[model samples]
Target chain A: MTIHQTPSRLVTIADVAREAGVGESTVSRVLRGQGSFSKRAGERVLEAADRLGYVPNRLAGSLAGNADSAGSQLVGVVIPSLTNIVFPDLLRGLTGALDGAGFQSVVGVSDYDPDREEALVAGLLSWRPAALVLTGLEHTELTVTRLRAAGIRIVEMIDTDGPGLDIAVGFSNRAVGHASARHLIGRGYRRIAYVGHDLGRDLRAAKRLAGFEAALAESGLALHARELVGDRSSAASGRAALEALMARVPDTDAVYFSNDDMALGGYFACLGRGWAVPERLALFGCHALDITEAMPQPLSTMRTPRLAIGRAAAEALSAGSPPGTIDLGFELSEGATA
Target chain B: MTIHQTPSRLVTIADVAREAGVGESTVSRVLRGQGSFSKRAGERVLEAADRLGYVPNRLAGSLAGNADSAGSQLVGVVIPSLTNIVFPDLLRGLTGALDGAGFQSVVGVSDYDPDREEALVAGLLSWRPAALVLTGLEHTELTVTRLRAAGIRIVEMIDTDGPGLDIAVGFSNRAVGHASARHLIGRGYRRIAYVGHDLGRDLRAAKRLAGFEAALAESGLALHARELVGDRSSAASGRAALEALMARVPDTDAVYFSNDDMALGGYFACLGRGWAVPERLALFGCHALDITEAMPQPLSTMRTPRLAIGRAAAEALSAGSPPGTIDLGFELSEGATA
Candidate 1:
C-alpha cells in the first residue's frame, strides 16, 4: 500500500506517514501535538519529515474551513500597545492560564487605531482562531461584521463603556475617570490640569476625560490647563507635558495623568525641580504598574485588574462560557502622590 | 448572478464572486487584500460576503502549497519575554520598519523555554508567515529540523552564540559577558558576585556567566558568591538575590546581574540600605533600557543594539538578504554604577 508521491508536491500528512512507515493518524497526532502517541512514533515521524523535507500542509488540515476543521487552539489577542506595562501584565496572566490548559496566544498590537484594528482583525480572523480578545469595545463596522460573521467568541477587554459583541471583561473607563476625579477632589485639589497623549486617538482616554470633567463639574471646578502630546504615552512625554503645563499655569495644584507611564515621567520632572510631591505639585495616574509601586512613593493611581481580567478571559474561553459581560472592577490606590 | 449558495459549505473566493456578481479575480483581489480591485467591486464583494456569512478560508488562498499563496504580509516574531524592555524595544523598531514597508507583526512569547518555543513555532508556522524571527540559536533538535524543512526565511535573533538556521542578526553573548567583565575588572573590582535566575534554563545568560567566569579566571580571581533564583529575572529577584548574596558574603564589592532587571533591583536595594552607588558597591547590567538612562544616576551597563538589530533583521528579511550573520555590536556605558 505504499503510494509514491511527487516530491515537488506540497507535503501532506499522508505523505509524511507513508514516508515514516506509520499510520495517517499517527502523523497527524504527532504534528498537531494532539492525542497520545508513543515517543518512538513521534521520533519516527520527525525523522521522516526531516529526511523527506516535508512541511505539513496546515491549510488543508487545520484551516479547511467549518466548525470542525481541526481548528487551532490559539486565542488571538489584540491590544493597544506592548510597551505599556498594563498590556504585558494582562498577557502574562492570559498566557500563563492558557498555556497550562494546552492553549496558546497569538498577539497583535493595534497601536490604538480603530482602522488598524480592523486590518488586524481581518488578518487574525483568517486564522479562524477559537476565540479573540480585543482591547476595548470600540471597533470599526467591518470588524464587528466580520466577528459576528465568523461566529467565534469575542472578548472585549480593559474597557466596558458599551455593550460588547460577545463577552466583555473590564471596568468602565468612564468609571475609572469618575473615581479618579472624586479622589482628587476629595483630596481638596483645585486648579487641576491634565497631562496625557492624544485623547482623540485613545478613545478610552477620551471617555475618562469626559468622566473626569463631569465629576469636576459637580465640585464646581474645571481643568485649568491641559497638554496634549502625540500618540505615544511615555515618561518623557509626561515630563515634557508637565513642564509645559506648569509654565502655562504656574498656579496649577495637581495633575492627573492618562496612565502611570506619564506619571512616572512627571515624578522625575518633580525630582529635577526639587518640588515636594503633593506639596508643590500632587500627581495621580491610572494603571498602577509594578514600576509605579517600586517608586520611592507608591504612585497614586487606580489598580485595574489587568492580570485578573486576562486570566478570567482565558478561563471563560476555555470553559466555552456563553457571551456576556464580566465586570472586574478597579481599585483606588491612594498612594503618597495624591 | 446572485445564485444562492448553501452556508453550510465553507465559502470560497469563487462563491463570493458569484454572490457579488463579480469575477473570481475581483473577489480574490479584494479578499486577499492584494493587487487592485475597483471600489464598486470591493464593496459588492464585502456586501455579498456579509450577506452570505462568508468566512474566506485563508488556508486555501494563502497556503496554496507554494510561494504564490496570497499569504498575509505578516512576519511572525517569537521572543523570550514581554515585560523585558529589550524585547519590546526590538519589536518597536521591527514593527516600525516593517509597517513602513507594508508588513505587520504577529508576535508570540516563548517564556525562554525551547519546548514552548517549539509549540509557538508550530502555531505561527501554520499561518505560513512571510518570514519567521526567533530569539536565539539554541532551538530544539526538532525545531531546527522543522525550520530547515519549512523552506521559509528564518532569522535567529538576540544572540549569535552559534550558527543560525537561515540568518543570524545579533551580537555574541560571550562577547558581551567578556566585555562586561573586562570593564568591571579594568576598574579594579575583584570581589564580584553574580545575581541571576535559573542559568540552566536561560542559555544566553549562562553563556554570559561563562564569559564572565572565564574573564575572572584569566584575572586570577573567581566570583565571591553567586545566588541563583527561580526561573524568572526581575528587580524583586535582584533585590532578594543581592540581599542573600550580601548576607552570605558581605565583602563582595561589585555585582553582575543577568540583565538590567536584576541590576535595577540591586540598585533599589542599595537605595533602601542607604548605600551609595559605586561607593558601597558598583553595579553593571546588560541591555541598557530607556529607564536606565532616566535614572537619577544613569546605570553603568552594556547598551546592546536591541532596536537596531530588530530594524536590521526586518530590513534584511524584507530585502531578502542572503543567509548570513549580521553582527550588530554592543556599547559599554561607564556610568556611576561601575
Candidate 2:
C-alpha cells in the first residue's frame, strides 16, 4: 500500500503490475509493444499504467531480465562517410525496411580510417546491439577478434571485393571496375589516367584500381598518369586532380575517377576549360548517384544497388537468416560523356 | 580467485578489482576512460584488465550506479533528412568537434513528421542521452513537455524562426527568406513563383515562405503561382514542379525553391529544355550545398553556416555552457544564374 502511495518516487513496472493484478512482465511486454499478451491483461496493464502516469524508460527496460533481449530493436550501422549521398541512400533503404519491422538504425561514421573504425566498432559493441552493419570487410585484427566474441548478426555492406565477417550484401567492385575499364577501352580510349582521392584509405577504390589496371593490361595499355589526392572525395578535389593530371600527362585521352565525386569535379574542369567532353577527353566513374544523372552530360558510371543491399541486410537480420553473401550486381551506364 | 579464473563466463569488474587490489569504481573509471585516478592506480587497473581480458559492456556500465550517469558520451542528433546534403554537413560539423572531445553522435531521422519526431524524441530520451540535438524549434506540445522533463542539454539546429526550448543554433529562416526576396527584387524580378515540398511538415520552409511573401508584399507584388509538393525534396521533384508551375504561370520571372535540391532540379529542367537560366526563368534557393556551387553556372543562393552551427553547439555542450542562442548567419552567393 505504501509502495503504491509513494508519489515522490516515479512509478516502476512493479507498481503497474501490482495495481493491474498481473506479473511485472505482463506490464513490460504490453508497454514495450513486444511479445504477446491477452487483450484483457493488456487492457488492465495499460489502464493501471495510465492511472499511475507511468512512462516506461525503454533503456532500463531493455536490459531488464523480463524483456526479450533479442528484441532490442537496435541495428548498429557503421559506414565510411555520412557526407556522401551513397551512405544516406543506403540508410534510406535501411530505414524504409526497418521502420515497419519495429527497428531503428544507430549510425556511426568511420571517415575512412581503419583504426577509427576499430574504435567505433568496439563502442557500438558495448551498446549490445542486436546486429552490426559495417562498410567493407577490412577491419583491425582487434576489431575482428572482438566482433567474433560479440556473436551478433554482422553485415558488411556496399563492397564485396573480399570476405565479410558474417553476412555480406553488395556487388563485386572488381567486376564493376573490370567492366568500366572494358567499356572505356572498348570505346577506343587508349591513353587513360586515373584520378581518385585517398585510395589507401578507401580500400574498395584501391581494389577497383587493381581491376581497372588488370583489364587495361589485357588490352596492352597502362594508365598515362595517376593523380591521387589525400582528402575526402568531392567535386572540388576531382577538379584539382584532373587539372594536375592533365598538366602532367598532356596526351591523356580519357580519365577514370575512383567514384562520381571526382568525376563530377573532372566534368567541371572540362566545362571550365571549354574542353569538349569525349571529343577532347573522355571521363568515367563509378556509382550512379543522382547529381551524376542530373549533369548536362550524364556521367558514364556503374549503378550499384546501395538501397537494395541495406534492405536485404535488415530483412535478413529481422528474419534470423543464416550468414551468407548476397551479391547484387551492378549495371554500367554508357552515357553521352563516354 | 574462482571469479577471476572463470573463462566460460565473461570477466566482471569485481574480478578486475580483486586482481588490481583496487575498488570497483576505480577500475570502472580507468576502463571507461572517464573520471580521475592516481597514475599508479590506473596502471594497476589496466594491467589487471589486460590479464583478465575484460571487455566492458558500455550499455551495462552506463546504467551501473558506479559509472558517471552524466558522461554517457552519446549525444542524440535528430534531423529531417540524410538524403539532403544539408543534414550530413551539419552532422560533419558536429562530429568534427565532438570526435576529439570523446563524444559520439547517436543519430535519428524524423523525416519532417512532428508525430514521428515526437516518437523519436521519446525513444532518444529513453537512452538518457548527454544532449538532444533537434532540427527545429517547432515540436509537438507533448514533445516540448517531455524535453523539459528530460533535463538534458537541448539544442535546436538549422532554423531560428521562433523561440527555442533551449539552446538554438543556425541562422533565422524568416530573415533568410526576406533577404532572398529582396535580392531578387533588387535584381528587377517582379513576377515570382515558389516551388517547395511539404510546407506543412517543414515548418522552417513555411516560415521562409511567410518571410518571402511579406517582403514581396512590401514591393507591391505577390507570387505569380505557388507549387507545393507532398513528397521529399529532390532534383527530379524540382524539375517536375518547375515544369508544372511554368506551364501554369509561364510568364513568372523567377522561382524561389525551398532549398538547393529543388533549385538544382529547376536548373536541370532549364538545361533539359534548352531554356536559358535567369533570362527564361530565374532560379534561387537556400543552402549553398556543394554540387550547387560546382554547377556550370553556380547557383544563386545563400550559404548558411551549417558546419559552424554544429561546431558551436558541440563546443558549448563540451564546455557545459548555459542555455542560449548562437545565431550563425547566412551569406548570399550572387552567381551567374540570378
Give the Å shift of residue B265 in candidate 1: 2.6
- After superposition, candidate 2 runs with Cα above 4 Å error: A1-10, A18-26, A32-41, A51-53, A66-72, B1-8, B21-23, B32-41, B66-71
**Model 2 TM-score relative to the real fold:** 0.90
TM-score of each: 0.83, 0.90
Could you give candidate 1's per-residue lDDT for residues B1-338 as a string of tens digits? 34332234456677888999999888878876788888998899999977766766554545553544325565778888877777877877787688667665667788888998998787666666788899888988777766655567888888887888788999999989988999999999989999999887788899999899989888998988898998488777788788888888988999999988788778878866777789889999988876666565668999899888889989998899998999998899877789
Interface RMSD of 2: 4.7
Q: Among these predicted structures, which one has the highest lDDT?
A: 2
Candidate 1: residue pairs that collide: none
Alpha-carbon RMSD of each model? 5.2, 4.1
- After superposition, the stretches of candidate 1 with alpha carbons farther than 4 Å from their true spots are A1-11, A16-56, A65-75, A98-104, A185-192, A246-253, A278-280, B1-11, B19-56, B65-76, B95-106, B123-131, B185-191, B214-227, B244-253, B334-336
- The candidate scoring highest on DockQ is 2
